[model samples]
Target: MKAVLIIVLIIFTSLSSGKKFRWCTLSDLEQRKCAELSKTLTAVLPVTSIDSFARISCIRAHNTYDCIDKIRVNKADAASLDAGDVYSAVKLYGLTVVAKEIYEQGNCVFAVAVAKRGTLDIQRLRGVRSCHNGARWTSGWNIPLGFLLARNDLSWDEAQPLSQVISEYFNASCIPGVGVAAPQLCALCQGQKSYVRDKNHFCETSSNEPFYDSDGAFRCLKDGVADVAFLDHLAIMEATESEQQEYELLCPDGTTAELSKYNTCNLGKGPGRGIITRHNFQKITNKFLTMIQRLFGRKGKERARFELFNSSSFGGKNLLFRDATQHLQLLEEQLEIAYVLGLDYVALLKGLGHEGSSLDNRVVRWCCISNAELRKCEEWALSVKSDPLVCVQGTSMVNCIEMIKSSEADAVSLDATHVYIAGKCGLVPVAAECYGQVCAPADEITEEMRNLHLKHKGLSPVYAIALAKKNAKQINIHNLRGRRSCHSHLYSPGGWLLLSRYTVGALENVTENCDVGSAYQNYFWKGCMPGADGNLCKVCIGDSEVEGARVSSRCAASHNEHYYGNMGALRCLVGNPSGRSFGDVAFLEHSNLLWNIENLKSSGWAKGYTAVDFELLCPDGTRAAVTEWAGCNLGPIPPSTVMTRPVTVTKIYDFLMKSQEFLGSKLDSEFHLFQSQKYGENDLLFKDATQYLVPATHMSYQEILGEPFFQLAESVFNCTPAAWNHVQQHPPVHITHSTELGSAVLIACNGGFIIFLGSSRVNALD
Candidate 1:
């Protein structure tokens, strides 16, 4: 059944989780401005193990899930008291030691408590009845765990479960501490045992009704049953006002002293709070610096920035300003140029020579269509000309030319920037926008790299299979001979080459014996290496290969805007907040996660790929003086917009319902366009746009192309009409209109992007 559960009570800010108490420490009590600044502000409840207090306020505040905002829960600290809180701090777990210390010192203390009625030390009752909430209490759990173990000389497993202990106390043992209720029991411990008759002492409904309790141990002390009550500093402060009037101080070793029941307390520190936003923290770092200056003067501001330094301010999302290596990469490729008003007016191009040379390899294509690490060779070399144009901003012509001329590639490609740079270099401005795109470091195949692909014409699968069979027969002969197989293992490369040939000759076709299988994924990390123990077992290749996925890209967090965004961008889906009962806590982590999934994901139909904006970095720290687009594929993300969470089988069902139409549409469109044209009609194909689809209904190539399409096809370019040579070739990204190739949709069986134009039934999506 479909379900929508509204469980927002688990989320909220730490401060307003409950009514103010008095047993809190002096510093803590001061921050609890419930008296002087008593403004009832509504906030989303943060996810908490015990969020009853915050839940009450949230239900009363907005009352509806849609209107709720600003979550209030304990700050996420990896060292905090709960596993749930630690998990929520996902990325925040990397904060430095000092930051962790500060966070601990604040609200979410790392300490727990030991309580008996209200008195902490229950030494008098060696075997008394003890009962209270389980270890769910941060303070109640931690303090007591440590304190009780030391005093009783016992470990956790050595201790009995509460129910069992209570049972034994009544029947077998004589322990004094018993029952988990606070106020009713605390009243008895504090000297007011009469309150045990009332149920209100343990309830949150009405304080006047006895069960209308405030703080757990505080009530135990209030009712006069216990001597000492323990709680975290934040909880202690928010619940009370008599700062020092509560409990007496205890030693770090857990020994307690008798004093006022609500006076002094012991506590540990925790990490503190800060602001969160979606923009790249570095780009607006200057603005952040200014904000700090205004808020805390210079030193405090600087310190604040320092505090946030390693906390996502400059991590995985941008150019490596934080990491020295990344900083160096940028320094290596930057080009500084200025555009004059009118002097520079021609396009400057990076002259990567056209295809066919060895040195002409475009190691990194700045024009990444939401992808990087140029796939297999050839295509990798011609990546420079992928994108059409880029305009560089510059100061003066002289400055621009110096920046442009000094670049690693050809002249900076721009209508004006190149004009000035070329002028400075004495190379007069030629034509602008005439040539589609210019490439540099013209490809020149080197002998060595070429040797890697040169076919020595090794044994084909067919020949190998025949020999393998013969070899397996010998292995069977040995087994049938009943001779034991030896297990000793040791071999040098020279020995292995000699031994391998024999082994291959013998076991290659062990398939005849039903024992043939691949070692490792058959490639990549060559099967296990030999060691003293033996030859490491190579991984067996299964039915799968290295998977490829594409998701929203954080590869460019500096720029959140996706270019040419279209319907495909809808692939992004907002996630349902968990742990947080509060509806309004906007976790940029969650939101950004969603944003990236959507921004980078597109159906095959949504060729709306995005690329990163980058300047060239050269080997020498000087600007390669190049600027262009680049892409980084952020592996497969949520298949559907609704899958804001990680991939799940259930989520796939929903994604398909919404995005099925895009399947095979790109190839289908090519087919339909080729089919739809009637002779003599104006051509629908336009060079300006990469995507072409009929408006009303989807059509196939066979269904669309007619006499008009054939006539239209003839007017534009000559179609080499030599019986359509139908052979698969690699991607035609660098497919040149050479005399030998003719006008054909060359497809390569081994290429990354599968092309299915000529095939009658096949379809391509990658």
Candidate 2:
């Protein structure tokens, strides 16, 4: 592995927890003392200190220089340490012997186990998200792997040392004379070991190289290259942006799942190792120093350090627990926080569903502002009463801060550069920026906020901030000096360029140091070519996601009744707005659903879908709301319909039925609204579908091709202009056919022409 020391130096933007105060949180006296001390402190840095001896130390976000100057028994002077060693040196100088930990914001599972079986079992976890940071792995990948392997009838002997386990799996899956089966795992390493694809899908070592190692382990979960992945603190704060989305916290035991029925057992515990503060100093301090000396003692201290950096060894636990008191108080903290969230046993059960939740039911509240800008933000925050965590955005810096102080919001999520800048000024940044979109800054500085001036005001359009649920993400601290950019060239996997969001973050803002959490960039105001400066985004371009939004138009249901389909049949299934317009791939798969113009563009279905498929189709000039009457006697009857089958193959009949019920209920309340004011209602074509669903016999697809509606199919095919459509249904009509075209009729015909090809018509064509 060539000591794969790819240092990815990322600025740590973790919060000290809402209850745990960060530096900017210093009281008046603390702040005054700290500022006075800063004059004496020369070297201060915000980073974790793990010595060759494995001693841990820390300083407040903005109190670095001053913290060093205060020089209490546990504090070290800033000037005494190197740029990187400042924190550790200060700790040593102050004689502080406390051991701290690096934890992720949210984790899927935290497994700690000896890999006797050797296999990194990813197979069992199909849909569940796993964390990337490995700190909690004992509860995450390891234990989960064990449970799965055990279930599959494998023991430590069979799974041992990853390599053997993967090979054994390959052999078992392969039949002697049969052709190779599609591998359940990623590509194979030499012999039986499983390997992962790099950013580019080219063949290479997986988790084989140090920097790339975390990726391979994560890839098992990320690209579905593997069933599960390993995560630790570094993976969270430091992984490239693209890696964030594939996972989230493991749902705790007895929690309900989004799908499925029946109660499931808890996968594991939901507790965390606390930063147990050491209230009793003298005794603990002496013991901690001794441990540090052992770390430096000539006998294999180097080996011990490896354990500290890598969560693969129990040796790592020593750094976390040695001098730190279990802070038994953390138990109270945990209980109280849970209470604040209003979590209950019943809610847990409902959340877990039948599968049993594998993740903690608790959610972490992550605020995006940097630590340096707390004072202004806090003052602003104190004034607001609504959401506690806020992603601040606006034309004026004062306004942004005022909102925070006025109880208008809590955290101000922002880019790393802005976040860091805020910390330098005095704010508590809970989580680093991951990825998400926002409107870009104006071309010129229309406001002080955009210009980077703290005290200025007056601005342009304020970008909208959309926050992900608190529990939905993970947080990590990065070490910028160590990055794997070098190996990306040799390890391109799947034809994708691999770059961390941090790397891209640095590139996007022209500001070299920055951080963030999660992934996605549509609402981003930074990172594009003409963005904040020069920061690049660590995202796979060309990929699209669907987002749904509220519109000015109200649901078309009459007076009081709620109609599920009235909001439109596809409402629940619709994704984010920027989602790629319906294309060939999604359309054929969901051929039965009704869609308007927006659905076609968003789903990428416009390329092949047709208006004839819609229950009611509208063109660009259609009205948003209308009332139509049927004039023809035959047309006065309820409309008819034909269904091929549920398009979602994986969904069971029950799920499909659920979807129908869900959509059908909206029929009255939601409707296809037209844009035009005055439109024809006297014609039979204007009649609303009276019957819920009229069925028709199934016939050869060719028979469908011969219907007069096929001519109108061109209009459906052109469904990209946000066309509106909504129609009631008729009774079910089923028809079976052999090799030839079968008989069918277009009911709900609105006197619309029916062009059926029977024997005589076919003979004429021949």
Candidate 3:
């Protein structure tokens, strides 16, 4: 009786202590395989005394994202994810890689471009028809595209969809899942195009798309529909002898080699699929994976009963894990997705789906502040039929910046001051407005000038001048204590920051905290400083009071205010169409000074005003003609930059460059991108004086602004505690979940199993 009681107690304790790991399944077949594995694990539990061995349970998820969500919320514990999905899970969802599937090629695969012998050279593939396994596929898309981008063979404007660039690069392609977004990419596809009975599967990411996976892509090349096929090294080896003999691997060096030379001639190498779970659950998940591999792996004691890696019995291919996976290998160290996947591969993946990299993938949402800019943006959207643009409205410039940061809007063109603020909030400049003859378009640029162009492109610095009517000689820079003023907007580099630092900071006994805004309000008697309240907004007039216009827009820091921007400030000083001037002095940018005067005269806003009527106030309290702004300005200000999330920098740059090519000049009678006079606004989307949009790619905000200007901005803004707090709050996205695993680790195959290793083993499951 005592022995039986002891045995019962031990059984009860084992049942209570056993942990049930819920494995997430993506499809019905995966669910079936997971259930079978669970039952097999349960059956073997009585024979194993390992307390850490978890009993498996199946949890069905809609897809990889759903699986990640489930694991994050603790509804599921683990799932096997592809390299791309693994990156998303780890970086975005904070999941950790516990183990990886090792195939004959170890834990990584080589991507190769395959073509019929002498069909085409790798470097000269610009206008050829191509075949790809699928969109975002590691071997077919990411690796090859990344390789081309690195080689400068392919140019990506960070502002547009990568698919657009690919579609334009290749004359035609059979890129699965991309036909809907870019139809030209699917021109070579051989799928059923009829929609009857749901038969339209053209360029779908399935068997329906004749050129879908590695096999399909290879078949595309074989059938002569595609000149080249992008796939993994294994795909070529899996091809028939005759097929392999006919196809040759295209090397990165613009040469070709036999199919067997994939190891030496390949686009790039990328990591294989891996199992992921919540960071805190990595240890238990690793142990559970280890237990399953020991039981049903290739050399498992119960291999005859069930195979862990094989899913053929369940009427599916790669159901729970890849069919080619030899065995589940536990990572000795918890490696980051970037380390597991090569840095380049990780970057490519990030560029595909990083924060602010438009989720829609079809249209870029340009944030427009005020009705006038929105009207112009809407017109711009209508004109660009090829690349659709969606106009999103914000009440103020700062609001637009916040919208972009939260990804509500994709991009916005900002002045130097706003650009600095955007940079602090993790935004980057994609393109900059070039306002003079110094800027040149893409076709006109030569190879030798490319480096210099890239560095100085869009960097046409403008003079920040304090403009006053020639008749108002009493309103000099030194004695403007009680004078009414007109400013471009609050925090504007040219219109506000420079003026404040040199005049307010130097003359006024303001505190070190740099409350320049308050000092400006106290110093100037009345002013039209958009975004400021009280006396600062007293002299401001809101948008031409149309029937339905918002009266609250009077003090808004956007085009909604009649007294906004360099042009608006000029308008305020010269007077509106009624010839009722509001201020004695105006602070604005000199690059647009003459242009704004011309626009105001043409638009009949300041009909009689000319550049001769305006004079720039010098630091020496003397006045100079508007054309002599070179020496009379407060300081040189950086040109306005198109700012976007760092990840979408290239995409934004690409979009702007393309847009400029299509609708940049005023000569495009249909619509002019730089002219906003017709919309009853000045510099709605870009400054009217902008000669062209230049690439600011690879240039940081500091580099774009130059040290002198950047330092001047910092001094005026005071690098406030709030800004430092924001930096601390939002560290670089990549380093947010970084773990300090004692030493650098790498994966290697040893004794027929793959394992992560440093100098010493950390958590070897075997």
Candidate 4:
């Protein structure tokens, strides 16, 4: 009887104690609010029968991180954390999100850079005074700074603190909580700094600091203490009408937009605060939160007595949850923290020194074409230590694309034309090469500028020009019929597609069902359109002479042919070493035009020709200096892009961005990433004129190619019966088919064919 009585008493004690859910509180005000919440919940429990409704108890912690630790150790059941802290909590503490704080804008918020209208240029933010909500905060520090780091506007050596990098990037900043780690960043702060030790509140992450949060940061900008303010979109939305009218958002693309357009014109978007609990404790915590929110949420039955989201009575902003939060949304699905925070946002945070889970240890297999590119790839493989790269050689660029699509290779850099074909093959662009002025100025390039260039280089537009010798007076855009031409390669955007759009398409009125290759073959009497057969190869001067003195590599699509890329096309127009000109006009990208001329001159191919000797054939039947390509060109072209499978896009981008940091410098003596002279070739692996590789993970092939250029590509690839017959006869290495109506059919006369039919899509892999 005594043993049974003792066992019953112990059982009752355990049940009652375990039924109490402890809530983590970071400050006194939060603890007070949590106590009130506990009382209100207990008061409402008598009216309901929720089995998981445990009596609430407040557990005090030092800070958010402490709260995370306390909850992880099971001392506390749950706590609300910002997106950044949520990443840390889930990543480091192995906690799980049970519910999210839903604001009026849903579960995510936009981080925006705001400056006085017409007062600042988004691209040139270096050395400017800036305001941030607080150190390590999401919209204030992490998002904005991470954006700069991701774009290459700020360079960081992972060994050093990120605060140091920010201090050097900006002249002064009002970043609360930076403290003494970076005093200079707090130079523009309005926090108290009295001689009395306790009175000093400079850069404190509290109300004591004048510029402590989003509202304070905005005030700093308005007071003219800071040139720009980095804060969440809600703060901007809450600003007075006149204040909104006085400022505009600085978009990451180097453009400015009105305040109302924050959705598209912000640094980046990220998840909102979420309620997290110990990994397996989500079931009970979720039910507990659901019950409390039901009674105190936006439309709670007892909201008039005690509001869950509102913190005014607690004497703090966003105490238990953001005051802006409307309700708590239960997240029932098991989700990876990265999925909740977003991959881009996670990448940004990872770049900003918030280390997360380890990166995949798999090596990236880079696809290479030709012996020269293989050698360069081999050397590059040895250069990068973090992301190991291995070389996989293919017979040609198209073959490389096939290899990548078949999982035999991981990545390859291709011109705009090939990028389109790759996209059709289910590959995506991870990065793009920026040439000339679009990149950071080589002479004045700083780490910050390099980073900025890496971020915005994809937006840089390329131009196509119709190049003809100054002596060819009759070779204007109008009288080019039957003239010998030198094209970069078949299906090349600037050389073939844009040229055909202006010349053949315009003259023949071939809107639909057009055979662009046949049209070019018939239009040009004799020409070297690399990758094409018959008459197109007649004018080609191959790499060298064979035993019978026959041109060995005539009209080949790669650098093995003497007349292949933009430089090679220029070489064709400049004539052979014996001064035997092969063509009257050349079509190619305007990038490095002057450099190509000088290179040829130095190589003795154009012994006495100067840049002035070349002229641009204007579309209006006029001729202008080559430098006037802006006013006299075929059309704007997109830059070259690095292609990879969708699953490997982020992995490839991370590798390339790191590679650029280590090897992109022209000053790097071991192996210059952009120079190919040592390989005895031009544009191997990547374009020789490339200044740097920019991240293109967020872009699609259409976005990278731009709407106009993409449309032009579509028109060029809309094959007619003749073109289809030509493709069948050539019988390329592989054939890809798409079922969707109006899908593009990209054909490479010498390499492969992509046919779109009104049937199921198929990949005819060899």
Candidate 5:
């Protein structure tokens, strides 16, 4: 029985589905034009088969309101409507606007007020007689009224209605469509008879009234009845075409546009009428958009046979679409129906005036280092009151920086290295973390002369140091070839960067094509280098695996990677399986070494390692005791810096300071805030070594890194590990045209030949 009913339903639906696309129309003339256009479309359209293609049919309605209702119920497919009507259709029926009508040179037109030159100014027109197109219309109502509400401090009471306020503001105004309930609103109407729908000759929405539409409102001003005419820019342009010297446009600032340039000389702008359809008919809307553009567009071939844009008989006004429209503009993804018709305009149409919703737009969105970083940021979010802060997480630091630029996230903490890259990519640094508590003020130590030594407690410079076994006498500091090595991570100051600089500079005849990771892998027999992906992770022996990810979380540069960071690298050297490949040397900071030696149980891999078991490798081809790190250190590395866009640098700096005062220290035991042990051997959001965050004295990357170090770092940054392969083979030259290989051309006057060697090289004429 179910199968039989399904077959019957399918057959019924298929039979009911007609071969014509129905478009809703408001008048009889539009229906006639629709029929004529449908017949002409067959010949004009370039479709392969006309019989299979849908034909155009018109569904007539009394007004736009009825047309929208019919379209919503699937009685008709589409209709063109003004922004005001479009807003109603979108709000009530969830309609999607496919395309908008383009007039003059813009997809939108502005509403303007016209008055006799030298007669009156806008500021003094409180008691002047005004002629409006109609109540609740774009040009006549929403535009002028919305602009006034936004700019002026109109002393209106909550008890008084919008119509009453408008009536009181303008002494005698012809605002058509105002009901009889608001008698003061319609007091300016010239018609003597009582309020009637279509019978009244004045202050009515239809053509029966003298000041109804754009033309009529301008006519009221032309005949010397109204002091000012409130209408669309197009209407004023059309009115002044024959009588150019009759009137002038009133500017917002009480000035006048003596010569008409509607683009610049207009009041408030609003989107024009757009073709709307129900949201459910997405496929139909797509097809209809293509067909309509082919039929009625500026370059449309069908428009040559039958004019779809213009209306001819039966009232001779705008029918299916406004006749004055030059072409149809397809809206992009960013623009929506509600957006096209602004919020203020929509509010006015719905009679809900804009009071305070437009104000109080302040939100500080913070970018997190990792998913785990969100926990602390959430706590911070609760603390902030004015300009509330919210947290958003990204996969990596790169992702966070990108999110900030795209407005997905507002700010993120960055290392000094990352600070340089972010600044190059159009981001600015907000504050720098000082090692000590005593900062020499933000401006006092901005220059290089000042030491900027805050002398704060519990903070000191982190130093890059090399570690090796106490009994390891087989490998010398200068000759580290074939010795298993461990690194903190790639690009880290104490690991890849510092080591790469020393090794590459010390090694003889080193070319640019040398892959640093491959070289490190080849240099070491077998060892752990955490956060190394692909070939770089060849020797990394991570114990734990990340849950359900294609990327081995063990090899990740993030906190998820088990064998990651300075401590992880140190553990790789000391805790390698007794018999198997154990790292002979480790590159890490001096502070992490002391911390791990003191608390062996903190890291899973640091079980059996002790301070007496390891020694530091100095550059002078000698190994020294671990306690002598001050003399054996490679270099002093700066602390991690916090950065943000220049727009909110000050706000972010203040927020950071406030947050640190409460939750940045170990005193907040509820959560070990900045301490790495809280997150299990991971410095997720901030470095665990950092005692506190302080304002950066130096601003630029060049300033932070002294002139000597800046020059060296810049040179190294310019050339990647494998840059030799990309080096220019010869001097580059401009080529007129691409030629085949081995092709040669003889010069016209000279006995020289220009030869094409390949795609890149060309032998020029001599």
Candidate 6:
């Protein structure tokens, strides 16, 4: 009975031991760090009723991969890994990233090529002798090779092994990982073959090889045995610290620069290392999160007791984390591993030598402004994540446009006013929203809209009109010098151009200082003209601001701003009280009037207001019904255009065209490509009245607004005629199915309707 009772007692103790959190340790250094960390954690954690603090036990493993396997099978709860190793654990073993390692430089490190000054130029790297850290590693291999493959300078056979292709491309190399696959891979390795000090080593991927780690690769170059050493920026920094005069970094732009400028002159970039754990240990991972932070974080309070990140105890580098890591960041639940590393890096790893998923390579990264728009974009991203769609958030449309120019984002849907700015920044219109019907076949075309191309419906050449109460006849067209007025924006054709020009000419104040824009600011006591000079925005209430400014003019520069665009001007007129920054009349597009008037209750302003309360102020000093805008409206304006960097027009066009085919008007889709429902605003992303999207071949600023109209806009915006002339002469080229690679096939839609279509739609064109 005593023997049986002792057996039961041993089983009970083992079951109780399971309550303790188990952390995987790969090396003696990691085991020692964990031992020190556990003691500190015991003191910090809350004690239980049994007087025992949160307990931690070490789980031993031979390598990081073994530790990941141990976690997967529940032998261990967690382990830290390099990004490349994290990718493997997440992809192959169902591991989850709990935290990311943020180094002093940041979460990302640049991969660069370093050589003796004047030894090699970036352009002719072909057949050059090379030194690489290892095969399939992020910084040393994937980044450098992916950069080469993208430029089409390095060609290889996908059917053959990756090692064979790499060997053939380089005249000689000391790449460390390939000795197992093929000995020729280490043909240039200078390590002693019989070094018995290390077992199963020499020209290997680990520290066993003399030319394996980043330091080893640089040593190859330092000894004058290799022409170029491809390694991470951190490695180069560490290796060349003592001998700075002999080495220089290579830039992708065919030049050599200082090693300190590696971020700007590198092959590519990759994410930092991270701590990975199995999904089942989420609770344990969460528990350890705070404990680990207190013990080893950048500002860890318990770091004095033990250095968790030290990687130099053994003759090798990299313990639980890279030695260079500054701290570990707790990752949010929604942040995916691939997303943290960036999709491009993951895609390269998916298929090193062969053509991987085209969808991966052709992801369309979009930029949006405002949290509301970002929410909508996130929804859109979910639908097209298979297309590898990604979204970047910006503060304003101007910021989005800048993102595209810097290659930080792929595209953004822009307003006509923004299109002009984007064009000046070297962007081209790919497709446009079509508002009017395509027009029945030639036989069915009507005489009133004979020209199908002129069927703008409610888009460009759109009439701009002044709306005011009928009783406001006291404000005649010619005698409104001191009247308060509302305008769409400072630079919009409808708000600033037509009305300002007419009012200035009427008042005979059209000189340089008293230009149309300034004259209106002086004439109107106070108006809600967005983007207008200072006091003009006194009546404005928008919160968003330009980069250096304190506050955004009350007019909306983006969806985030209130009363910013044509609709904003209408809101300014109807929402604000008259004479207190509100206006007796509003200068805006005719469509904004029609759209908002029908949905006033939805607009949250002018409740109980009706069309009978407003009338059009014609230039001829006569009042007319709002419906009579055709007769009373100002000069026509061009339709809104979708613009992108000239280099990416073709790719963006192809993706958009494909998207529309499945989610286009013909398909029954869950999401509307050109719709939003925030505050009952129908035209958030694209215009609500859109009919289709069309190509905009040979479209120019001058074409959108005829030369005379363009000149007027230039004057309003204070643009030089020479510069304006240049914008007109070189019309933006649109990429099309038939257009050659070097040329453009500009596509346009009417009324700013964002059409969801693709190359399939191109064939649908008559």
lDDT per residue for candidate 4 within 1-766, as digits (tens), equals: 3443343233333334335788887556788898898777566543333233345778876556667889988888888877777877887678898777776656667788999999887788999999998777778877677566544566665456768888998999988767688888889887678877556667766556777777788889999999999988777776778987899999877889898888778875556678899877777676667656666888777788899888888787777788898877776557665445443345445545566324332568898866678888888888887668989887667777767655567789988888877776556778888776667644445646645654554346678889999987878887788999999987788777788766677325653336667677778888888888888888888776322333656777777677888888988887778878579999998877887888886776768888889899988889999888889988887888898755455557778877877674436458878778787667888887777776676566888787777776665554444455444433333543311111101111111123421112322222
Q: Which ten residues in a row have the lowest lDDT in candidate 2?
A: 488-497
TM-score of every model versus the real structure: 0.21, 0.20, 0.53, 0.54, 0.46, 0.48
lDDT of 1 by residue, 1-766 (tens): 0110022221222223344211110111222321111121112112342333321111111111001111122111111112111112222232211111122121123232334324444443334433222122324332333334323322222123433422332212111122343233322332123454432222221112221111434455445544444443333433334544454445343466333322233432111111221122212222322332232222332334232112133222111011111101000011111010000101111111111223222221111111111121123123223322222333222223333332222222121212211322222221111111121111232323222221221111100000011112233211212211111011211111112222322123322211111111121122211111111222111111113321222111101111111111111111111111111101011112222333333323123323221122221222211121012110111100010000011122222212122322333332322111121111111111111111101111111222332232222111221101211221111121211110101111111112223323222211
State in Å the error of residue 398, model 4.
15
What lDDT would each prediction earn against the true structure?
0.21, 0.22, 0.70, 0.71, 0.58, 0.61
Considering TM-score, where higher is better, how would the candidates rank from best to worst? 4, 3, 6, 5, 1, 2
Given candidate 5, what's the lDDT at residue 678? 53
lDDT of 2 at 736: 15
Best by TM-score: 4
Q: Can you tell me which runs of candidate 2 are displaced by over 4 Å? A: 1-98, 101-121, 124-275, 278-661, 670-766
Please give the range of 10 consecutive residues that has the lowest summed lDDT in model 4: 740-749
Q: Which lDDT tens digits does candidate 6 get at residues 564-601?
A: 66666777776642323467778887764666775655
Q: What is the C-alpha RMSD of each candidate to the true structure, in Å?
A: 32.4, 28.6, 13.0, 14.0, 15.8, 16.4
Per-residue lDDT of candidate 2, residues 1-766 (tens digit): 1121111111112212122111221123333333332321111222352212221223332222234344343343111111111222222333221322222211111221111122233333433323222211223323333334323333333113432443344432111101123232223221222343213221222122221223334444444433334432223334444433323432222122211110122232222222222233323333432332233222323333322222223222122121121121111211221121111111221221212334322211122122212223333233322323223433222223223322233323322122222221222222111111121322222323222221121111111111111221221112212211111000011000112222223224322121211111222322211111111121112111111322211121110101111111122112223432111000001112233323445445333334332221112212111111111000110111111111101111222223223434444523221111122110011112111111111122212222332332222212221111100010001111111110001110111111121111211000
Worst window of 10 by summed lDDT in candidate 3: 740-749
Residue range 694-739, candidate 5, lDDT tens digits:
5552354455544544554444444443432222211111122211
Candidate 3 residue-wise lDDT, 1-766, digit = tens:
3443344335434444456778898556778888888777666555443343345678876446668899999999988875766777777788888877777766666788999988887888898999998777777777777667644577776556778888899999998766477888888988778866355666765555667667678889999998999977766765678876788999876799999988788875666778888888776666556656766888777778889878789986667787788877677566655546544344446555543343556578899988888889998888877887999998676777766754568789988888876675446678777766666664465434444654754355788888888888677888888888889887788767788765666324434325566667778899898887778888888865633555767868888788888878887887767777588888888866677788876877767778788788999889899899878889888888898764455556667777877664335357888777788777888887776666776577778888887877666544333222222322111121222211101112122111211212222111
Better of 1 and 2 by TM-score: 1
lDDT score, residue 97, model 2? 18
Clash number for model 1?
150
> In terms of lDDT, which candidate is stronger, 4 or 5?
4
